[model samples]
Structure formats: structure tokens, C-alpha cells
Target: MARLQLRNLEKDYGGFKAVHGINLDVADGEFMVLVGPSGCAKSTTLRMIAGLERVTGGEIRIGDSLVNDKAPGERGIAMVFQNYALYPHMKVRKNLSFGLRLKRRPAEEIEQATRDVSNILEIGDYLERLPKQLSGGQAQRVAVGRALIKKPQVFLFDEPLSNLDAKLRASMRVRITDLHKQLKADGLQSTVVYVTHDQTEAMTMGDRICVMKEGRIMQVADPVTLYNRPANAFVAGFIGSPEMNLIDADLSGSTLSIGSQSLALGPAMLERLNPKAASALTFGVRPQHFSLVGAGEDNALEGRVSHVEFMGHEVYLYVNVEGQQMIVVVSATAYDRSKIQGDIVRLQPSQETAHLFDRKTGENVSLADLH
Candidate 1:
């Protein structure tokens, strides 16, 4: 568990920069996850930490040592790749002990390390089997066991569960979380940085998640902060399931209108608006925040439901209102299916929960004055 610091880090091939100058810190024993869409340079960042990719510029520090010039072996880091990267020819125990054997470690120590890792991973019974005979999850455990045998300072995982089936991936996620905790309890100085494009893994696994787009970080926050208070429109739209509903509207001196229809927020919410914002703005609301409110001036908007989807425990309904679309999630037991699609209804959002952003800048302006 080592503290890592990356300052003004960059990766370039000739004139093209794959990764811009990025700064980040990984606390000792912290589980940090880097997540982004394809071509966002998250995998590049993780590989740079593993010494698999050269740092075009900036310093890479593990604990107090600047390791920019160190080779992968010299940096004392073990990387678990997406493919599991196991040796098909070797038995599980042999694969697990390969690194130690390559380093010419003593027989007794190697045996003890292999035994301990297998026990920790609960793969002790499969040690004699070859990789070909093992299940996907078992093979992955062997891959992790290989890394553990080296007992390196840092662990880098790049979409390690991407190859597994849905059920296996879910199970492996829990195992990996438990494995991190188990490692920390042993007082090892290991820093972990996992890279994934999957939102569920990033949300469940990371102590801090760095959301990236176009090789730049949009926001780096814990899951709770991200879900409740997004930093920008992209982050808000990208981070949530089904995303937040964004609607264009008119903003006057003291009133907000969705075209001819007017809606209102609490005084506290209104006070946060830009004093000069009399032109227009965008209002955002999460699906779960919307509810039916009686029609009235400056209260709600009328909408005709277009579709409703039943997702077992809840309902997702799409409503078209005021030339815009809104998604609402309702309790399964409360919302009747028969009146879902054709009903003409008025919908309102809680005053405090509504998020308002500047139309041009897309910055959060709803609660700016209150803060």
C-alpha cells in the first residue's frame, strides 16, 4: 500500500497527445477507479502507472521514490490485465509461483507464498489443475494469485472482469472488494488503481472515481457526491442511470416558463438564480424526483404519457410535455399500467430537488446563490 502522485502527467506520440497533462494522487491503500468512454485515455493512465507505457512527461512517484526511469520489474508493481493473462501450459500453482521462481526465491518461501495466496483467494483446491481445465472465475483467481505471489507495492487492474459472464462478473466484483479489504488488514503497503468503462463497477468499487471525457477529467468525486451534486451537464447526464432529464425553458425576472406554461421553485431556489438571468435557462430533474401535481399557474406542466416500461420492482414512464420529453420512475404498486401511456397529466418536481443550469454555459446555477 503505497501513496502515488502523478503531476502534470502526459503521453505523446510525436505531436499527437493521447493524454493531456493530468494531476492525481492515490492515497496509500486507497481503491481509486478511472472511468471514461472509449478513447478517453483511462487505460493509458493505468498502464503508465504499471510501467507498461512510458511517461512522455511528468513525474511518477510511488511512496517517496520517483519511478519514471524504473523498469516494470524495478518499480515493484503487479498488473492484472483484462484477459486474465494466464499461462495455458502451466498448472495453477505453477502459474501462481512463476514470478517468485523467476526471481530465484527459495523453495520454502515460494511454497509458503503460493499456499497463502491460494488460501486467501479460496482457490486452494484448484492448485493442481491446468488453466485449460479451470472456469473463467477460477482462471481469474489464478491470475490475481499470480500478482499476489509477487507481493508488489501496487496493483493495477484494467477491466479484469470484462471477459466474465454477467453472473461471474457480479460474483468476482464482490470477491475483488473483499480481497482489497483482506489485503489491507494484513498491513501491506499496496495502492490499487482500477480502470473500467463500466459504471456499475466504478460506482460500487471505487473510493474515488475520476470521470473522464476526451482525455480530460470531467469530475473526480465519491459516488455519493457525484449522484447528488454533479459538477456539470455532461457529468450529470453521464453518471446516472437513464440520466437526468434536461428541459429548455424561459427565465424571467422572478418566474420560469416552459414556453407558455409556468413552473415555480421555492424562494430559496429562486434566490440562487443569476440576477441577470431574464432570458432563458435549462432545468434538470432526476426521474425519481418528479410527481403528479395539480394543474395551476406557475406550478406544473401538462404532459401526455408516451410509454411506460415495467422493470419488475419499479416503473419507467416516458412523458411528452411542452414539446420536451421527461422520464419518471414510479413505484410498481402505485402506478397503474392501464392509464400509463394515454393519460394527460401535470407533473411537478420538488422545489429543493430541481437543478437549474445556465443555458449557454451549462453550469449549475440553481443553488449558486444559496451556497
Candidate 2:
């Protein structure tokens, strides 16, 4: 049982702290993703777990072992890098078996392991090809095969799919998730810690995702929980495609004054608000949560269409609400093409899914009652 745990894990680069004291746990056979924008200390945290970066404070436990002082190879972890770090001079087979060869395993054992991994990754045909002869996707497969060949207690991936194109990245995402399931079914220790800045990757690939900001962890949860019930304004904005619309407003007696328009927050929505909520708030609603309604509708925000994007199945309507820009996604078939720029529209936000954040703290004041 190789359950990974970090207790107050920290990394201090000289005087500047890169990773604050953060605690996390990755259950055995679980795929955990660390995701955030650049400079969020996610990669630093992954390196520390792989023993490449020194932990300034706290403990890192892999099952029964405390491996903060161990070398990278001694941590029973295999890492796949973004660059597909296969040995340039060696063929795919040789690259896959290098670690086993270094440990002086018998030739038969190394060859069998390489063959097994190559088949699993579907790189058997490229066994004799050098790294330079392979395409980006093929090279990435060799990198994953190399890690799989190790059968380590934990697997670490550092933006492994970022180098590939959009289409390839999508395919590889499915491949990696399928591989994790395959390993788990085979009773292998498949604990995975994957790091990426892409929220889409985190959402689709991880069993649970850990979101970090600066040197602090923002939130850790499954994709559904993070999307439908974000803990704060940051997670609500960061995890979505076009991002959640966060606009400043004044909440007075179950009514929200957004710019020049006033919205009556119905009693059901009012009951869901935190009792300690303040008057000043950052109203949060996703673009998809907004419905295009008739003009002069009650409890709706008035806006004028500024721009529109005609996606195949849906239309992205960009509107200027007062001075702030807001986006509403409507089905292409339902959108009237006659309503072009400068057209007035009303957007009704779904009260069940709307969020209210404290203006000063950026904390979701309506979150407690949501649960």
C-alpha cells in the first residue's frame, strides 16, 4: 500500500519560499493532479516529492517510509518529463530498460520488462527506432513506457502532454487515464502525481485535483465539486473555460444592485446566503449559467450585445453590461442572428447556481449554505 502523504511540506529557495507548508494525500492507486497558473509552486512541489528538490521543512511519507532524505532513485518513484527525456543515443528498447540495466538486472528480466511496457504503450514497432526518429507523440509514448517499465510505487508526470498539439494532447490524455486504470486492475502500485497548468487536463484526468496559487493551496476536490460548488471566487474563475463572471455589486435586503440594474434575489436564493454575508459582494455566475431572456424582464440584468462568436453548436454572446463586459452562451439554433451588435438583451442568472463572494476576502460567502 503506497499511499503518499505530505505533512507541512515546504520548499525555500534561498530566502524566498517557493512552496508553503501544505499538506496533501494521494491514496494508493489514485491519480492526483496538481494544477494552477504559472509560478504557483506546483512543479516545485512535484520535484520535491520526486526528491529532485530539497524540502526545507515538513515530512514526505510514501507508505511506511519517510523519504525526505532519500535520492530520487531511492524514493520508489518514476517521473515522466515534458520534454520526453529519452536518451538520444539509445533506441526505444534500450531507453526503456536503462534503469533496470543500471541496477544490474539479468538481461532476460530487463528484456521482458521492456517488451511488456512497449506492448502496453503500443510502442513495440518503434523498439529499434532512436528518439530522433520518432514523432512528438511517439517520443512521449517512449517516455511513458520508460516510467511504466520501472513499476515504481508512485508515478510523477510534469506537464507530460503539454508539448503535443491540441489533438495529440487530447488523445494522450485518454491514453494516460486508461493506462492508470490498467495498472490498477493488474494490482500494480499506480499512485500518480501529475502536474499541469491546464484546468481541462486536471478535470478530465485526475480522480482528485489540488489547485495551488502562489505558494499556497487554493482547494483540493473532484472536478464536479470544483465546478459546481467552488470554495471561493478564485476557483470559480480559474476552473472554467471562459471563466466565471465575477462582477462587483451591492447586496441590500435580498436585492443585488449591479451597475444601473437591480435584481431581486428571490427568497430561495436569500435562504441559501450565509448569515454573515456582507453588503458588498462579488457576484459570481458562469457564462453557461445565464439564459437569454426577453427585454425588461424582472430579476434580469440589461445589456447590449458587443460581439458574438458563432461556434458550431453554441453561440458566445459578448455583451456590455453598463461598463463591464459579460459573456452569455446560448445555443446556436436558439440565438437570433438578427440581434447583432448594439442589440439590447436580458440575461437571467440561475439562482440555484449563482455564487456570492465577499468583496474584500474573495471568499464565497454563499458556499456554506450551498452544502
Q: What is the C-alpha lDDT of each candidate?
A: 0.84, 0.91
Model 2 alpha-carbon drift over 4 Å, by segment: 337-342, 369-371
Clashing pairs in 2: none
lDDT per residue for candidate 1 within 145-191, as digits (tens), equals 89988988889899999999999999999999889998899897557
**Model 2 lDDT, full chain set:** 0.91
* Global Cα lDDT for candidate 1: 0.84
lDDT of 2 by residue, 265-291 (tens): 876578778988989999998999998
Give, for candidate 2, the lowest lDDT window spanning 10 residues.
333-342
Error of 2 at 3 (Å): 0.8
Q: Give the Å shift of residue 291 in candidate 1.
A: 1.0
